[model samples]
Target: MEFLAIILAAGKGSRLKSNLSKPLHEVAGYPLITWVSKAAHAAGASTQICVISPDEQQLYRELSHTMKTVIQVAPKGTGDAVRCCLPHIEKLPKDCPILILYADTPLIQADTLRDLANRIEAGTDICLVGFTADDPTG
Candidate 1:
């Protein structure tokens, strides 16, 4: 089945209390953005689009050619970030599966994503992934 991945990387990483953007922050040895993108690619997404703020666009320059980029003009919310990628979404086939992922969640595994898509292809109405947080407190 055809698949498209939309990685939300526009967040400012304010919660991390760091100057670096959330997507630019490193997880393990790679940037948070790279981990998510590589996972999406590994999961067999035909195309990947990473929505990021204009200022943080350069953080993903290496993937500019292979991965599509959408710039969020305003720092709205996740809903708005999704809207920023509407054009790219529209270009896809009407029935293509769209996988929405967050860049900051770098711990996600490729196998997990692949299984989600497989479930969808097998006739699930919609698939959602959840992780058990060690600490729920903010």
Candidate 2:
């Protein structure tokens, strides 16, 4: 099935207590958002988009060369974040499967995303990719 991956990176990572953009924070040598975009590409995403806030645009534009970046000017919730991407989503083919992903979960794998899509292909209207976190606290 055709795939479209949307990676959300527009959040304010207040919990991390870092001056850097959260998605720019490195995990295992790569930025968290980069890991997500790579996984999406590996999982067969024909169109990949990484949504970011205006503050992050310059840095991500220089860094995320492979994935397209969409600007979310407002800091509304995820619903609003997804709405900012509708223009891109609408341009895609009707049957294409859109996968929503978060930038913070650097540990998330391509296999897990594929499994979620497979479930949808099999017949489910929707499926979530869940991972068992070893510890709940950051």
Candidate 3:
């Protein structure tokens, strides 16, 4: 079955207080989106799509060289960004599974995604990628 990994990059990240898109921010010397994209590829995703703010088009193009980019014209809730990508989602084969991911958490590893993909390939209807924090007060 085909798999589409949707990375959400539409947030303005007010908490960050910088001009950069959250995912385009540097993490461990690499752009956060790069790490997320690596995990998506490792998870056996045939294609990767990123939902990003339309105004951030230049940033998106600079950061995500190998993935498909979907423009979300307005900043809204996570659900809204996903809705904006619905057309691309619908164009996929009916059986294809779409994995929704946030672009800021670069620490998520490839093996984590592999496990999710395994479960998905085995017919699981939905899967969420998560991590156990080493410490909450770090």
Instruction: State the lDDT of candidate 1 residue by residue for 113-134, as single tens digits.
Output: 8888788777787899997788
Error of 1 at 31 (Å): 0.5
Candidates in order, TM-scores: namely 0.87, 0.89, 0.84
Q: Candidate 3: misplaced stretches above 4 Å? A: 132-138
Ordered list by TM-score, greatest first:
2, 1, 3
Clashing residue pairs in candidate 1, if any? none
Tens digit per residue, CA lDDT, model 3, 36-138: 8888887678988888887787667775678888888878788888898788888888777777888887877777777776777788988875667789563
Where model 1 places Cα greater than 4 Å from the true spot, the runs are 60-62
What are the RMSD figures for all models against the true structure? 1.9, 1.7, 2.3
Off by over 4 Å in 2: none
TM-score of 1: 0.87
lDDT of 2 at 89: 93
